[model samples]
Target: MTNINDNHVDDHSNIISRIGKCIKQWFIQDFDQNSGELDAAFKNNMLVVATLIVAVTFQTGINPPGGAWQDTKVEPGGHEAGKAILASLHLPYNLFLILNTLAFSMSTQIILMLVYNKKLYFEVVVATVSMVATYGMAVWSLSPDKDVKLRYVFMAALFPYVWRLSFQTFKTFFINYPTK
Candidate 1:
């Protein structure tokens, strides 16, 4: 005689078995649709992106936003204002420093992920988005525009979809990945 507890346990086991079989079947059914080229493309694209971020980080530090460092605050002919390092650690320099560090860190993480054969697409997307934010800070420092709050609001608005897509992309990349 099966007790009620036994029936409950059996029901749970059945549900788990069904879910596992469905997952296995789905993978098996769709495995053939994925091609080797897709994996290679993801790898190649990651390499390109990592290299670009490193390059951009170096360039941003060397050239800077407003311009390269200048000894004088004003140009020789009183034309354009020179971009001297600020008197204190003010917005421009502080922002640049923060962004530069963040960009470097994110890019380095991406590189490490690639080198370690870690195919986590969410990490890559997040690092890319961080780089975007870093560049946005850099741009804010350079531009004389006055719409600070709007940019923050816009970035906040776009972040949810970015995160969701990052997770979705991570799953898809794994699914579409060519298995050896």
Candidate 2:
């Protein structure tokens, strides 16, 4: 019985160690550009998916959940015209804005990555900036609270860059560092 219990313990430890390695490998997996697998068709498919994401996110930004305020009001708990009705709820509205902005940012990044032509790339970048600005304005006009809205928009927009920086830092210090 004692020997059987020891084997069970060893099996559990081995399973846990394997799971840990798999999780680490998943995070550290790199996109091998020269692997001869990422061809033009794959790039085109990715671009189409990214473009769809951009469109969906843009639509949501313009027409947020809970709709918009129609008339101006001065009383407490009352909102101005053109503001979002969901703004009053605070938490859900903030989550919705942040997630939507993050989706928009990531989709735009994918589009930028896939475009090879210089002129087209430049045009996409300009359009991306314009879309971001329009989204910001839509959020601004819709949200009643000034401080929180700006924070959410900027944080969500920069999250992809921040995420990449963090991953690079981890890969450098932990994954690529001398293991000996």
Best by TM-score: 2
* Predicted candidate 1 versus true structure: per-residue lDDT over 1-180, tens digit per residue: 879999999999999988966765454442124432336567668878977877787567545655634443344432223332331334655555455555655565556555543567667667666755665555455433332233443444355455546755655765677432
RMSD for all candidates, in order, please: 12.6, 4.1
Backbone clashes in model 2, listed as residue pairs: none
Query: What is the C-alpha lDDT profile of model 2 across 78-121, one tens digit per residue?
Result: 78888888877878788888999999988887787678464678
Q: What TM-score do all the candidates reach, one by one?
A: 0.36, 0.74
The prediction achieving the highest lDDT against the true structure is 2
Regions of candidate 1 where Cα sits further than 4 Å from its true position: 1-38, 72-89, 117-180
lDDT of 1: 0.55
Compared with the true structure, the alpha-carbon lDDT of candidate 2 equals 0.79
Worst-scoring 10-residue span by lDDT in model 1: 78-87
lDDT of each: 0.55, 0.79
